[model samples]
Target: MRIKVLALSLIGCCSAMAWAQQKEPTKPAETEVYEPVPPKVRVNEKGIPSDAIVLFDGSNLDAWMSGRDGDAAQWTLNADGSMTVKDKAGDIRTRQEFGSVQLHIEWKSPAEVQRKGQNRGNSGIFLQDRYEVQVLDNNNNDTYVNGQVGSIYKQAIPLAMASKPSGEWNTYDIIYHAPVFGKLGEVIQKGSLTVIHNGVLIQDHFELLGTTEYIGWPKNKPHGKGAIRLQDHRDNSRVSYRNIWVRELE
Candidate 1:
């Protein structure tokens, strides 16, 4: 019994010594990843990244087409490097389709302030032509919280009201993720959106339930890449847009 006890103690001591002598990580680089370096992207004077695809630079409507009949865009191109909605003409959309992307766009309401509420400067930027990020001149105008400026139109209300003055240019920086669909046309992963309005964080990674609908429940019909659509509102709201760009993501 004494011999067996001595043997057990030796084995325990040997195990403890082995564990104590094992080397631990000492430098940060020991676990740092150096491969797969990201490519360089130069930002221009206008803050546009080199890797981005400029949808509109205030020059022409080359990247856009009418959303109604796939005809030429009927919006009015302004002398000030902007495009104004031609009332009743139709909505316009990008010719190229995209799945997930980072989008930057600047918009402004008419300086005259013709109407109020949803009738005043009502427009929207639709991601994948399905989900809407509402645009409204909510400066002193009151409306439903879910349909206000920067809201994900009836689906997600913005965290804050981050609109600029009714006529001044307001910027929207949006990061969007496309939904993944299963083989049976069901949603595997829901989409998400992060929006920064006029330099303020309005939507913080909000998961989308489905399409932003106006008259019924949100729907999740399976679809692939879709174009970015700009609404006309068809109410003579006269919303103008400029400096639009996008960066496609994997």
Candidate 2:
């Protein structure tokens, strides 16, 4: 019986030693993936990626329509390749609808400053026409941090203030992921936003709660792909936008 136990222990030890002697790949190519080749994208001199959809190139409003009634966009297109808000003309939105995307847009507040707080240079870039990335001239201005420039509206506060001067062009590069909903209008996965303001990281992949609301809590209403809407604000803010483009994500 003792010799039998000793033989069994020896067998186990030998098996363990044999397994330990097997080695993993030491070369990089052994684990490299090469079948799925990524497509090439060319960036123009204006820094527009070839695969990106040009929403606004300062040439025309063909890609946009009235946000209120879906008519011709009424924003003022300038010679310098920028569009200024038409105040009472209502908001403008892209004619094309999208889901998750990478959006790039440049905006500038009026050179001549105006009212304080939410009234100054107030506008917004709405993803899915629901989630808003607050657009305001926060340079030398004070407002609620969660509603300031680079914020995910009243939901997520920005990590930092990266506003250029009021009149200077400030760029917003946003990577947005739309929410996934269950069959019965329940949230399966919350949406998220990553925002870069004027080349500075402000919002770091912040998960959104729901739709951005000013007077009440956000509502999670299940919906499909939606248009990108630029807020009018209707305050005579005269916020200008240019060089708008987006790259859709799979």
Candidate 3:
């Protein structure tokens, strides 16, 4: 009788312990306590934040240089506070190097549509001078969806086509998180991009696989902060840009 009672008590104790070990529902971990408040930034009519680094204010290309030959950017500066890409001038890149940033830029394809498919307005916005966010004239035009405007080059495609007309200006607000490199020059963490094209979210924190190569497979060349380059394309697409600025993220 005593043995039976002890066995019953032990089983009850084990059941109680098991019930205590089970997880109970609770509130989520609070992260708001650890986050700090960001500073306020006053934006101008051009939509450039006060803390932003004005790359092109429709005035000059002083902040840019030739990406191919390291010479001064040979793109044409117009009177309307915009710069037109000069055909065969090679690519132009920012003289300053940046990592994670919020970049704002406006671009427009030639009013006179010249070619079709990839040959038309075939420019690109390169992050870290390697990863490309295509800047093609995808308005009423169709090509490979992966290489269209607002795409993460040949890697991630856009969520939707949010391009304006050929002559109308289109804006790109890009949030880029640069890749992290390990000690042996290997990629520790891949980069990511979130793009808003004309107030519409196109690329939503898209992960970058590797370098945006035109041909062959994508390559991962471990690099630090790099210049923001614009492709020349040599297609005479006459792509124009204006009111470019960047705000570094902490």
Model 1, runs deviating above 4 Å? 1-27
Whole-model lDDT values for every prediction: 0.92, 0.92, 0.88
> What is the clash tally of candidate 1?
0
Error of 2 at 4 (Å): 41
* Candidate 3 local lDDT, 1-250, one digit each (tens): 3443344345445687765774552533321132234588998886778899999988889999998889999999999999999999999999999999999999999989888899999899998899999999877788998899889888988998988888899999999999999999899888999999999999999888899888988888778899999989999989999989999885
Cα lDDT of model 2 by residue, 42-127, tens digit: 99999999999999998999999999899999999999999999989999999999999999999999999999999999999999
lDDT of 1 by residue, 1-250 (tens): 3443344345545677665674554765444554446899999999999999999998999999999999999999999999999999999999999999999999999888888889999999999999999999998899999999999999888999988787899999999999999999999999999999989999999999999999999999999999999999999999999999999997
What is the overall TM-score of model 1 with all chains considered together? 0.89
- All candidates: CA RMSD in angstroms? 10.3, 9.7, 10.3
lDDT of 1 at 245: 97
TM-score of each: 0.89, 0.89, 0.85
Model 1: lDDT equals 0.92
Candidate 1 lDDT at 108 equals 96
Residue 153 shift from truth in candidate 1, angstroms: 0.7
